[model samples]
Structures are given as C-alpha cells and as structure tokens.
Target: MTGVQKLENSKRNKIQAYDLAIHDWYQFILGYPPHLVRHYIEKFGVSKYDIVFDPFCGTGTTPVEALKNGISSYGLEANPIATFASKVKTYTDYDPDLLLEYLAYIRRSMESSYSNYGIVEPQADLFSYKARFCTIKVKDIINLTESQLQVIPKGFISPKPLLKVLIIKEIIRSIENKDARDFFLLALAKFIVKEAGNVRFGPEVGRTKPKSDIESIHSFTTIAEIMINDVQKTKLTGQAQIMQGDARSLDKYMTRELVRGINCVITSPPYPNEKDYTRSTRLESVLLDFIRNKRELRGIKENLLRSNSRNVFVSDNDSRYISSFSSITSIAQEVENRRLALNKTSGFERHYNKIILHYFGGLYRHLKTLRPYLARNCKLAYVVGDQMSFFRVLIPTAELLGEIAESLGYRIKEIELWRTRAATATKMQINENVLILEKK
Candidate 1:
C-alpha cells in the first residue's frame, strides 16, 4: 500500500504505540482511537485557545487526546465508570511519590489480608496447584448483594478472582487521598476486565474460560506502576472536564462560561444495534459501585442514547423529534417488517424498530441541544458505523445522522469513510464513517 493508504488504515481504529500514555489507562472496546481525534483536531485547526467537546465520550479518547495536544476540552458521558476513567486519565496533578506510597500501603494491607486467610508472605500464584488448595472461610470473602449479583451477567467472574479483587478494593478504599484512591481504583478496574474477570471482548462482551484464581496483587501493582510512570513523563498541558450526563440534554451540564465556547466536536456515539453498551462495562460498573441494582442499571440506561433494544423504554419520546423524517422512519419500519416476516417475537426483537428511531432521534436532540453552545462555524466529527445487526436490515448510521444534523440547522460538510467491518450476521462489509458537520 502507498504511504497515504497505510496512514489511513492505521488511523482507522488502532491506537498508536506513542499514544498509550493516558489513553490506555482504561478504554471501551469500540471507542475510536486517539489518532482519529488528532486527525480532526488538526483538520479543524483546533488550537490551545479553542475548546473541543465530545458528547458521547466513551472512556475519554477525545478529551485525553485534546489535553495531550494542549487544547482545553469537555466531555459528557452517561456511564459512571467511563466518566470516572475520563477524569482520572486526563488529570495531570498527581504526585508519583504519593502514588507509590499509596501502592506500598495497599500492598502491605493486601499481604496482611492474605495472611489472615492462611496465605503466607510473597503470595504464590493463586492459580498454582498449592495455591488453589489454600482455602478461606466463605464468611471472610466479600460477597455481592443479591441485587448487585443480578445486574452482572452470569459467569462474568468466578468466586476466587472476585474475592481477591474485593480484597484489593477494600484496601484501596482506605487511602485518604481521593485522587490517589481513584488512580489505584482505575488500575484495578483494568486488572478486573483484562486479568481477573472472566469476560472477553470479541467486540461483544462474552465469557472466556474461567480463571480459577489470579495473582491479584501482582497484576494490580504492575498495572498501577505503568500508570504512575505515564503520569511522571507526561506534562498536563490542556484541561479536561468529564461529566456523567445524557448527551441529548447537554445544556443541563454546561457551565455559563462555556456557552458558545466549543470550537470543535469529535466523538463516536452508540450505533443502532443489538449490542447493549452497558454490558461491555457491566462487571466494572457493578464492582465499582457505579451500578448496584436493577433500578440503578435502568437509571444509567435511561440517560444514554437509545441505540439498542435493551435500553429502549416505553417512556422514551426521542422518536417524536424525527417524526417528519421519512428516510429514518422508513428504516425503522423496514426493521419491524423484517422482524414480523421472520416470526421474531422476542421482547427485544419487538424493539428493533424503536431502536433506529430512538437512536437517530437521540442524536438529533443532542445536536439541537449543542447548537447554542458551539462557537460560530464550529466543526464536528461523529465517528459512527453502519449496521445490519437487526434481522439483516441495514442502518446507514452516519448518513442518517447527517440528515438529522442538517434539520437541526447544522451544515453537513463531508462524510469521510474511516473503515469497514464485516456485519456479524451477514459477514458483508459495512462502512464506518466520520460524519463531519459545521455550525451554521
């Protein structure tokens, strides 16, 4: 491939090695890469004086990149765990010495906890035969409440790993410094999903072979040291503020000083599909106390863009915003028609049509809510993909989103193709495009 072609391919979704300092602390599996954000930041001539914003800031990829480039940015995320991560990753005022001190304290506390359970100093690999034979009383293990247990998918974590994680979590909580505690917690979150938890992401949250036990302390400290080193080497140039709120009503979270202040926007909102965005972070969310019960889970979903069958609620009226747009309504109708034709009668299958309408409608609401806050001629890039997840019906997400933005008085600049992926059901390639827009 030519150099330009190779560059485009690399920028599609892969995070470059040099960009891992803060971006890799914790991230969503489907989040757009930092290079993609840099592409738009440069394309729009975003500078230190300009403010960048990401409404659907999953794990702060845009905000973290913006800060790295010395551009002040703001991000709004509906998921609490993502909001927490964005705040932690973009924060630059941490003391490495203090972090190390906290780490030592945490290690000592963990070692003591292990000894109480009859595990000795220099804890062996929990998965080892002798280690596996080591036993702890059931009452000593930290257990989730029935409601918390119900929220996480069955088999997402085994008992031993969960016990070790909870032990570390308790030790981390005893630290007095909030930032230090959060820094440690973020590292633990990574260890949970990547090491301790039985979850795997093939782009969809699913189970892997269960890990009988894990060397939790070692794994957590290793992740923590990497994060601490990144903080030590990187200079925090730009400012970032991440808030947990629905994107559709951004005005609720905006400050008076930021009114009409945003010069550029870059983000990847959830696409209309069967994949529940919450499931990807369910283990962390519940484990971290961001979500505790069915009620709390519903509350988080209600604040997000209705992009999947799982979050489409009867009380939702986002579809009413696009009542006159036949192009979008037709797609929703077709999905429903396909569902009926195929005799798909499950509860989730029944909501396929609504997911399309609600998804686009939610974006429309977001763009409309964001207009008054954007500076004149502000450029926006939404990284979204086409999907055929529902009964083999295609949803041109970027195209339809552009149409919605236009009706809300934004000008459609261009729809740039980022990459294409095979549809899960049909295995046919589908485009993931960056829908560029400008405030008129």
Candidate 2:
C-alpha cells in the first residue's frame, strides 16, 4: 500500500502488529494484543544514561512499559483514575496465587457481607440496574449484611477500591466467557471517567478511550496470567514507575535519582478538548480516595491545558494564533476547502485550529519545563497528528517542538512517520505521525 493506502489499511486492522503501534483497544479492553510497552522499548532502545518519563502517563503505559526493560522511569498524570490504574499495572506482582489471594480475600468478606445490608440490602431498582450494567451478578452481592460491609477483611481493607474492583473481578474470575471479561475490564476502565463521573476523551485519539457508561460482552479470563506480561511479551529494556504530580512543576514529586541521567522524553499533554480530567475521574476519584472529597476536586476542571476552550487555559485573543494556521504546508487546508465545497458550517476548521495551537503551545511549554531535567544527548519522541481547520493546518507539532527545543538550546534530529493512520478510527483525522527530537 502507498503511504495513504497503508494508513487507510492500518486503521481497519488497528495497525497493532506494525512497528508504529504504541498500544491497542484489545490490550486496554481484552488483553488479546499483548502489551505495546515492551515493543516501544525495543524500538526506541534505552541506555544507562536514560531515565524516562511520560508526563501524561495514561494508565501508566509508559512506566509499566519502562519497567519490563528494567529502565528506571517516572510518570505524571493529572487524571486520578488513570493515574491509579497505571499504579495497579505497576504494583501487580505476578507471584503465584496473587490473584487467588485476592480472590480468597473477597470470598471471606462476601460471607460476612451477608449481614451488612441485612436481608433486604438492595434498593428496588438497584438490582435491576446493576444486573444490566455491571458484569458481576448484583443479586449475589446484595445479600451481604452491613456488618460484612463494615468489617472489611485484611485483603479488602482498603474498603474503598475493593468493592468497585470486586464488582468487576468477581465477574472476571467467575465468568466463563474470556472475551466478555476482557471487554468488560476495558469498558469499565474506559467508563471510569464517565462511570466515576470523570473526564471524557478529547478530539485527539491518543487521549485513551472515551467515557462510556455501557457494558460490553467481551471475556475476562487470563489471556496472559503473568503480571508485567506486557513487559516480557513485547521484549523491552526498562521498567515503569508511575508517580503523581503537576507537570508544570515536576520537581516537587520526582526524586533526584529518578530524574538524573535521563536520555529521552516522550509524552502528550492534554489538548484543549473540553475534557475535564477532574470530572472524568470524578467517580473513581471518590471511590478510590485519590482525592479527599468532591470539594477538593471542584477546581480541577480549571487545571486542564488551554487546548480546549472549556478550561481556563485560553485567552480571548487566542483566535490570533488560530488564524496563523493559514500559513501551514500541510494537508489540513484541503480539509477546509472540502468542507467549504460542501457548503458546511465548517466551524470545526477554526476550532480545530485553535485546539491545535493550544495543544502545541501547551506541549512547547511542557517541553521547556522538561529540558532542564534531561541528560545530555537525549532523544524526545512525540506521537501526534494534523487536524484540518479553517482552510489551514493548525500548529505543526514536529516543527513547533523543533522550534521550542532550538529556542531552549536543543537541536532538531529526526521527524519520521511512525505509523499510518487507521482508516476506521472515528476518533480523529488520519494524519497520525510521530516526532523525534534531541537536546543540544
């Protein structure tokens, strides 16, 4: 296939088997595709001078991937649910009976739970709704008493994440269907923003899956029972360490050992996509104690990057930058012309331009923030795409990064086409690409 044809073909196949793939829907949803982290490490290669980091750190993909290669790495995530999920992937020890131990923990607690809610624990519609939405059998859990709920066993002592995760795990363990369980986990994790009332996916595709309240029929059996399976499966050279902190100010949370002698940096910060990372993780945030309370999370909507107009990051004059897209040497202008040819509102053209500039500008700021911490001769890679807007291609991610790095005393090394866009993606445009940079 030609580059365009290859890109189109890859979309339908999800292009996971190819070299450009960083992740897939199955591994996130079903665990069928294997982990992409190991693949990333092998492709990029790590060295003793490398201490990697992912600023966005969605579900800890980078950190978890880093761990397999035994490379010391760091991650920062604003989304509480995603941050926590990433931690679970990192902490899960594939020791024998680890799953069984957690299973036994729940069984003992379930036995006593019979007394917590009393005989009529469940509300009228609660049973019906749970039956429809969740993978677990709600009726079985409803019978547990208040005493059982009150006295959380040692394994379930967290009292917070136990019930929620249990609702899903019980179904995964007990359900005979493998595909259903896997899909359920992905759907559940994806819905966490919505299920837990957190943020939703932005216009960009890599922001992880969208907020979905519905349940899928996929299986949950251990596709790969081993913990850190992604690491070994893909063949990598570093281990992952996911941490929590504000990227604008990363020095506070990251240790000196973690940041010292880092060779490369790779990540994508939040685009201004009207997505409130705070609201998206709201449900999981409350259930997981990732946040103390709803009140503390109230202002998180304000913390998002200016890429989306919904956040505080944008200014009234931001349209000036949006207008500058008229200058790009990209395929986006054809998109605008096509829309105009159709006599459409085509407002997305301008909005997308604003969004793109907002995204790249935010990335530029973050790149500057990260420059001080990276070791000499570091390589930086970014996965990005071009969105058509108002007869212009908005900010060029690679060029913008190059300019920012040059301004910060770095050099532009390589800008290569990583993977062709999958044609079937309803998420965004087909201009999926990657950027590679180096510090001077």
| Winning model by lDDT | 1
For residue 201, give model 1's deviation from the true position in Å: 0.5
The predictions' CA RMSDs to the true structure, in order, are 4.0, 10.5
**How much is 433 displaced in model 2, in angstroms?**
1.6
The weakest ten consecutive residues by lDDT in model 1 span 126-135
lDDT of 2 by residue, 130-205 (tens): 1212233456543334433332222212333234444544544454444333333443453343332323333321
Q: Tens digit of lDDT per residue, candidate 1, span 283-340?
A: 9899988899999999999999998888989899999999899999998899899988
For model 1, the superposed segments whose C-alpha errors exceed 4 Å read 1-5, 8-11, 120-142
lDDT of each: 0.86, 0.46
- Quote the positional error of residue 417 for candidate 1 in Å: 0.5
- TM-scores for all predictions: 0.94, 0.59
| TM-score of model number 1 | 0.94
